[model samples]
Target: MPIERLADLANPATTPRIVFKVGSALLFGAGGVPDREWLASLVAEIAAAHARGQQVIIVSSGAIALGSARLGFAKGGRGSLADAQASAAVGQIALAGLWSDLLATHGIVAAQLLLTLEDLEDRRRYLNASATLGRLLQAGAVPVINENDSVATQEIRFGDNDRLAARVAQAASAQAVVLLSDVDGLYDRHPSEPGASLLEQVKGVTADVHAMASGTSGSGMGSGGMTSKLQAAEIATRAGITLAIANGTHASPLARALGEEIGTLFTPVRRDGARKAWLGGRLRMKGLLVVDDGCARALARGGSLLASGIVEVEGDFRRGDPVIVRDQAGGQLAQGLSEYDAAEIDRIRGARSNQQEELLGYAPRSAVIHRDQLVLL
Candidate 1:
C-alpha cells in the first residue's frame, strides 16, 4: 500500500500508535524560554491523536539546553561535560513540569520517563521499560521520554533524540515514528544547493540514501542532523515501523503528517512480533545453538527452545545475548535471546526441562529462548 494511504487523516485508527520526536530547536524560543505557544499546539495535537484512538509517545529534547540557559550560559557556551550535565540536572525538573502542566490543561496526564542507552539495551531493563510505556498508553497517559542526560556519560549517551525515538518506538511496539525537526524532509542534495529536491518516499536507507544526507543542516538547536535521522530510519524500518522526517517548526505538523502533505516517508513490510523484531535487528549474535531435528521442528511450529534441544553450544556468551539457533547439521533455524549463558546451556544440553534446575543448581528460567523472543530467520 502507498505510505500516504496509511495516514488515514479522517480516521487515525489506521496508525494505531505514533512516536513523535520533538527536538530542542523547536522546544525553546529566544532567551531559553519555553515555547509555550508551540508546545500548546503540540499538546492539542496529542489530545487529538488520543481522541482518535491513536496512542502517542513523545521523545523530546530540551532539558540540557534549557538547563544551560537557566545556568546563565550563553547559547552554545557549554565548555565542559560538567557544565552540560549540570544544566540537564537543572532543566529536567522544569521540563517535566512544563509537559505535565501543559498536558493537564487538556485533561491529559503526562508521565515522565528519563532513560539512558543502558535502559533499552539491558534485557531486564528493556523488558521493564517496554512494559511501563505500554501501561502508560493503556492508562491513557502520554509518556514524555528523554535521554537521561544527568547520569549518562558522553561515551554512553544516545547523542541524538532521533535514534532514541526510534529505539523507543521499537520498545513500545509503535507503528510509526515521526521526527519533527527544522527541515521538511530528505533532499536529493543539500536543500540549500540548487535543484536539491525533497524526496517524497524512501524504500529503505541505502548507500545512496546516506549520500543524500551530506550537507543537510539540522535546526542548529538539536544535536542531530539528517545523518542521525537516516540512522533512525534504518533502525525503525528494520523493525517494520514507518518513520517520517518533517518540519515541526511549521504549524500543525502532525496534521500535515496525517494529511500526507509533507515529509519524506520510509516504509517497509511489517515483520515479526514486537519482541521478535528486536531479536531480528542488528544485534551481534554471540553464540550458536545446534538443535536436534525434533527440537527444530518444534521451534518452526512456534514452540520455545527447550532445554532438551540437545544442542551443541558454540561461543562463550552471556545471558541475554542474541544467539543463532541451528539444526544438527548447523543449518541456521532461527535467532533468539538466550536465557542462560553459554556455560549453563552446555551443562543442560540434552537434559529435560525439569532437569534444568537440577543441572544448573538453581531454579531454571523458562525456555532456553522463549518463543516471544525468537525470530525465524
Candidate 2:
C-alpha cells in the first residue's frame, strides 16, 4: 500500500491505538508559558480521535521549560543538573495541570505516568507499566507519559522524549506513533539550506535517512531534533508501529497529520507476537546463558532452552530477566526472559528436567527459558 494512505487520519484502518510525541517547543510559548490556544487545538484533535474510537497516548516534553519559568530562571539558564532537576520538579506541575484542564474540557481524563529507563529495562517493572497503561486506556483515559526528570540523573535520563515515546509505543503495543515537530517532515538537507527537499515516505530509517537530519538539536525549548525523531522512527517501525513526523504549529495538528500528506510517514514491517516484539526489541541483556551444540540446534528448531543444556550462566540477574542464549562457540542465537535466577541456574547447570526438583527442592518449570518466551536473533 502507498505509505501516504496511512497518513489519512480519516481512515480508521490507519489508526487504532495512536501515540503522539509532543515536543516542548510546541507546548510552551515566549517566556516558557503554556501556549493555551495551541494546546486547546491539539486537545480538539485528540477529542476527535476519541470520537472515532481511537485511543491516544501522549508522550509529552516541556516540564523543564515550564518549571524553569515558574522558578524565575532566565531562558537558557538551565546551567547544572540540579537546576534542570529543580525546573522539572516545578514544571511537571504546570505541564500536568495544562493537560488535565484541557483534556477535562473535552471530557477526557488525563493520567500521568513518570518513568525511568529502568522501568522498561527490568522485566518485572515492564509488566507493571504495561498493565497500568492498559488499564488507563481501557477506562477511557489518555496517558500523559514523561521521563522522571526530577529524579533522573544524567546517566539515567532518556536524554529526549522521542526515544521514550517509541519505547512507550512498543510497551503499549500501539499501532502508530506521531512525532509533532516544528517542521513538516524529513528533508534531504536542512530546510533552511538552499535546495532542500522534503521526504514524504520512508520504508526504513537507513543511514542515509539519518544523514538527512540536521546536526543541531531542536529549538532551545526542546532537546530532540530530527535526529532523535529518526532514532524513534527506527524503534517504532522495528516493533511494527508506523511513525509520522509532522508539523505541530497548525490549528489541528493531529488531525492534519493524520488526514493529510503533510509529514514524513514511516511504514512498519509485519508485526510479530507480543513475546517476539519484547524479546527482539530489547537493547540490553541482563545475563547470558551458553549451551552446547545440541541445545543450539534445539533453539534453532524453535525449542526451549532446557536447564540440562546450559553449560554456563554469566551475569548477576534475577529470574524473569532478559538473557542472551549463546552457543558454546560464543555465538548468540536467541534471547528470552529466564525462568530461573542466575544463581539458581548456576546450581542447576547441566541438570536434567527430573533432577531440577531434586536440586531446587521443587521444579516450577522444566525449561530454563521456555520457547514461548524466546526469540531467535
Best by lDDT: 2
Residues 249-336, candidate 2, lDDT per residue (tens digit)? 8888866776667788888755667667766666568899999999999999989899888999999998888899899878778889
lDDT (10s digit) by residue, model 1, range 1-377: 22454364225555787898998889888778888988899888888888878888989899988898888876542567887788889989999999999889988899999999878766678889999999999999999999988888876778888989988999998878889888888999888899989888898787799898953345566788999898888778878888888878866777775565677888864556666666665335778999999999998898999889855989999888888888877676788888999999999999987878889999988798998888875
Model 1 deviation from native, Cα RMSD in Å? 6.4
Q: What TM-score do all the candidates reach, one by one?
A: 0.75, 0.77
Which residues of candidate 2, in runs, are more than 4 Å off?
A: 1-6, 74-77, 283-377
C-alpha RMSD values across all candidates: 6.4, 5.0
Worst 10 residues of 1 by lDDT: 1-10
Which pairs clash inside model 2?
9-258, 9-259, 67-91
Q: Where does model 1 exceed 4 Å of error? A: 1-6, 74-77, 215-217, 280-377
